[model samples]
Target: MSASSGTTAHAPSRAPWLWIAALALLVIMTRLWMSSAVSWDQNEQLVWSQRLRLGYGPQPPLYTWLQWAVNLVLGPTTLAVGLVKNSLIALTFVFMLLAARQVLPERTAWLATAGLAWLPGIGWQLLRDQTHTVMLTCAIACTWWLVLRHIRSPRPLGFVWIGLAVAWGVLSKYSFVLVAVALLAAALTVPAPRRALLSRGFWLAPLVTVVLVSPHAWWVLEHWDKASGSTLDKLHPADTPSRLHGLATGSGDLLAFLLLAVLPWLLMATYTLGKFWKAPAAPAASADSKHTSSLPWVEPLLRHYAIVVVGALALMVLAGASKFDGRWIQPLLLMAPLWALSRWPQAGNNARGARRYLTACLTILVLMCAIAMLAPLRDAQRGNGDRLNWQLDAIAASLRNAGFDGHGVILAEHHTTGGVLHMLFPQAKVVVCDADDPGFHLGCAWRKAERARAKGLPLLQVSTETPAPDAWWWAAWPIGSMPECQIHNLPYRWTDPAQAQMQLEFIVYPADTSAPVSAPVAARPTLHASAHSHLQ
Candidate 1:
């Protein structure tokens, strides 16, 4: 039997591509309409994107480099961030579809790609609050696709592409090493993949990876504490009572992470396909059969996933790790849908079943979009708010009205506030004051802040909470005395009568006598009453 005999009819040649593009557009539009404020991860990325560097704290520099590039073109606005994030998300879907097509029939490939929307990590969390994780997922997907293609028909250039993808993945997140190691281990167990790996051109992969990653590697060596300290602290927490207890906790967390990341796709597939685990009857051998069998590649891919999970647990036990975040396993679990579909290719033979699965995926996408669009209104109704609802624009206006030009230095209590301020006043130097750990401070921003202070330029300190006179940041006050702060009670973006106003306090330090006074503000923007009608 042909591949199509074991799968649904081929979809229109361009239908899947069009759907992917349309889905991307819908997500981007929804995010643009949701709120202008950046989420937590977005804020961190914006702050780091102020300047390019070889490394950033905790995470690798690739995502920051991309963000900086986008900001260079788009001027550090929310739109710049949104576009970069959504594009990676769309690329992820494209890569997954391409990889699936290599191992399964065309229709099954589309279904596998659609099934990604059912995973909460990819579907909702990515849209709402993930940054580096999104980039890493895209890189992993690209790597998988390239590796599969290379395995099917080995080529020297194919190894080069895989090398580039691997380098990109590592630079996106350090955890990607686990995936890479697992892939190699699993590939060695299979004949075709093993022979392909032994090819002379395979040496090019590591050479390319090392050459591309050398600069960042040097930076990590020089700044080892800054690069790996926080991650180590998280993995080996001081509070762990004992190794035995730590292993138990870590294993449990790892299991929970896998389930949360993969269960949605698994449950949804089972519901739609009905007992897909059952093995399908083998097709009778025929001389005219033209379809390449997927079993060789699919089996190894599944083994690769298994090794990733088992290896993660083993590392946790070895390192005595006590905590695990579900997001960390994203790259490994990203291909779960493809693996599930590959197990029984005949699962897609039912036209009604395929349609039902596609419909369910689209429904999830719509629901996620709706949730994002309505998030601000929901926060307002509940009388609690996050960064999204903060009145950053109004706060910026109030600062300008206070005879403070956007030319000096701003010290913010949190990175979220600092990021927003940096975006609003791109000319000003913004430093986050809340990083108690000296290792966490971004050296570039700190140096700029100090230089601006020494020059007696406009210095402003802003915070949501009142700062004590003895606060660490106050030590650098140019005036040598504590300045009186003006407290503004600004309403959130969405209005709820019962909601309390957010408190924002700011202090402006005196400038040098030789410094020119700021020009009088013209057409100061006033805060407007919240209109709930627009959101509805």
Candidate 2:
């Protein structure tokens, strides 16, 4: 519901710089001190950074391009890549504050800003990984703020920004298509905003957005399999659930997830509301103020927020995508605290409630940072590790010690292994041999390796398993044409002692013209037991 237009703006009761500064420091320190191993998403970005393009395997290129650019200046270390994500998160927090300020006073605005620390999706996902979805969260925050501003002020530039933000959001992740639809629907549903739909300003921003995103759109059209295939894999309907059952339960399950996600904030909001209800109500408005009441019953800002979230849930149900990642809906909740504060006017102004909100937010941040630091150490002690825990430098050195002259291609059956090799050995073309799996295939690299084979370059097949007679490589080259191959069992140990180890071996296939390089004859590396590891 809309607030009275005649409501006078009060002076902000507090400054927000301290909250911003604290958040900045927390982001910086966590990225610096957290585990050295990159998460799955971060590792993918590192691989994507090696070859910059407008589109990559089954996703848009904006986030990967951003990482590549950031890594250029910061170096491709775990900290530098994480800083790009942290910076986006910091920007999202600022944008959230700005959006809140439009509908809320400075004190409530600060509360909403700090409340971001409570969203696990924001805290854990944004802090831990620099993925396309994280970038989409930042884009969504910026878009919503612009959309709200445009609803209030009807500025041409606001629409342009809304258009740009939506375009960027979609380019970051395809799911943002839902966000763009929700914003447009919100604008059309409300009469004041509906009027602008016919205006030139309304069309200008979308036109600019179309112009900007046209190149990427062309790339998507050309690479339809990559663009759409990834989405299908995630949303693929399960046969076991039965279509009717999935449809029946999807929306309720989604709504329940949303409720549980915000339970902590809801509790605090309820307490503030309780205190507001007990306190004396404000005096009745003057009769003259009736004419100043806002149009469309609901504030367009709140209307847009509700519409976006509900619309997403509705879409999910209709599509029968019963399963969803909780973090996917993070962008919709950016203004949740602001919306709550607006609903209970007293909560926005209550000094005690404001203090408690800040304190709670700070406490959560501290606890999360401590957990982030300790979790990896605990994982190490337990002999657990993620894919990123491997010793890439050592592996590269070991490969050099064997017959690899740094002139051939290194092909691995797993994306995890290939991604690390690509990052470590920039000179060699690292190819993922498992092209049969659509999700892991890098078409360009696979083709490049084939071309390299035609030129008689050495090919090293690296795998965790021993070479079998009937592997994909065997099919690629005829038995008579195949180069002389030597099996070298090298123990690839984890750099972190707390992490487990594996027996990774390299199958060296020398070029037809070249002599067989001597293997590690006397020095057999010690291998550790293969322990379980989690992927991010």
Candidate 3:
């Protein structure tokens, strides 16, 4: 009772929390609005939005749903989606603070919230507006909410939050398994919460989660082989994010995620390790009930936070035995900070105590945000805002330049290039290059068929978008009688069918390009195969 009263005495300061939260929100809103003008994932997002299905060719549905919601509310713009996603990310700080407050004082909570507001990876992801990051953030918040609920009141309702958490985790991204695993570990670790499993509530969570995910599962079944292969390729990563860089990536990601949360995380991590090391004693196994003399209101929460940290992390590593990218482990980052701060030792003086721990985090967070938003600074940084697609322009120019009277068909294997071409040159008809997806190949076929209906003549395919990567085509030209082909084998397996590439070199079948030129047009400017490799 004395411990509870003492913790109540150290209740968080509303003033500083409000000030920091407001500033953090301001920064969030600014970054979000700034990102609205152009989209990094615009092409994929546009496709997903229009298609409107449970699953996509590669990505999960979270970003699409987010994009759809943003478009519905503010109407469509690249910037608007960016802002919305960023705002949602920034809002997660409230969750962090609430979670922290259960373990730390109000002041510490605010500081932690402030730190999280601009934590590098978290802030960066919010601005980027990708599905993986947002889904992970939602999953983390759900986890925190469930943990606190169980600690405060372990019941069937508490278990219901767990199920909801899993549902959102799945809907957001298939990686919700990691979040579920963390929750399971959290439920088991805390003594008060252990009863959760014995009740009907435990299995109810998984059952509800499975029911919610049935549609996506069906979608996967519909495109079984392709989906499985793509997912596998993504997990194992053909391009080498092999575990070493993966570890550094995860560590760096943690630092970034923890950057803006507060000094308490810094203090707690330092305090625990420094004390545990310098003092050199095993933390009491029964420290939860007795620790109130030293720790705060919900010391159990802190202990659970540690279990969540390690458990979620172990699950992440096991999963990453197949996948990488720091963002995928986002939920882990969020939970880790909460765990770190919750363990923060109580110092007699709150002001000096918080200042010493939180100063670096807050300072760096604000400073980096300013640097990121600075126009010149952003441009100078690699992977910052300046990157643009020259490939789109090149593809558009080739088609436009090829046409004698500016009337011809432009086809592409994907809608990305077609959409880019449409945006770049609205007058030209852009069609999907795929032979299989008729809707994709329809535009060019419709244009050519219309022309033929008016005056019968064979259509000509203007240019293929296969120049740069297929540079080895010269060696493989007349690609017949090759040893690999003779064995009915292949070299450098490309993901798509040959119909996927623009292979027609003036052949009648795929729509020939080299018909006789009209008079006054000099010899059709022949493309040197060698120059094809120079494409940037």
> Candidate 3 — worst ten consecutive residues by lDDT sum?
482-491
Query: For residues 105-160, could you state the per-residue lDDT of candidate 1 as single tens digits?
Result: 67788888999998866887645767888988899889889987787778899889
Instruction: Assess each prediction's global lDDT (C-alpha) against the native.
Output: 0.75, 0.63, 0.48
Order the candidates by TM-score, highest first — what do you get?
Answer: 1, 2, 3
Candidate 2 lDDT tens digits, 1-536: 22445455565444576567676778668756654556567766776786677788777788888887886786667666777777787788878877766555466567777777777667776336647767887888788677656656676777778778878887888778877776677767766556555565778877888987898999999999878876766665545368877776776667776775676666765554344545553333432222212123225546575767677677777877765666776556656665655544445566777677678777777777787766655655566644444555656676776668766777776655666666666566666655345433335434644565667787776664333223344434433343334343332232344344544555566665355332322212211122122121
- Per-residue lDDT tens digits of candidate 3, residues 1-536? 24544334443456654755565566665554343223346544643454357776555676677776765665454444455565556557666766665545455455556556434456556345365566568567756766665555557776667677677777776566665665566556655555645465667677777887788888888987645665566555666557786555555554544344333444553542333224322233332543232333344544564466555655554555344455654445565555444545343235664564466555655665675566423443322223231233344444434431223444334454343443444334444433334442335344443453245333233223333122121121222311110001111112122322222221111123243322221112333331222222
| Clash pairs, model 1 backbone | none
Model 1 spans with C-alpha error above 4 angstroms: 1-12, 279-293, 435-449, 465-470, 478-480, 510-536
Once superposed on the true structure, which residue ranges of model 3 sit more than 4 Å away at CA? Answer: 1-25, 32-39, 117-120, 126-129, 196-204, 225-228, 238-323, 345-349, 356-359, 375-385, 388-536
Regions of candidate 2 where Cα sits further than 4 Å from its true position: 1-15, 195-200, 238-241, 271-300, 403-408, 435-446, 455-460, 464-499, 508-536
Instruction: TM-score for candidate 1, please give it.
Output: 0.89
The Cα RMSD of model 1 versus the native structure comes to: 6.0
Clashing pairs in 2: none
> Candidate 2 has what TM-score?
0.81
lDDT of 1 at 479: 32
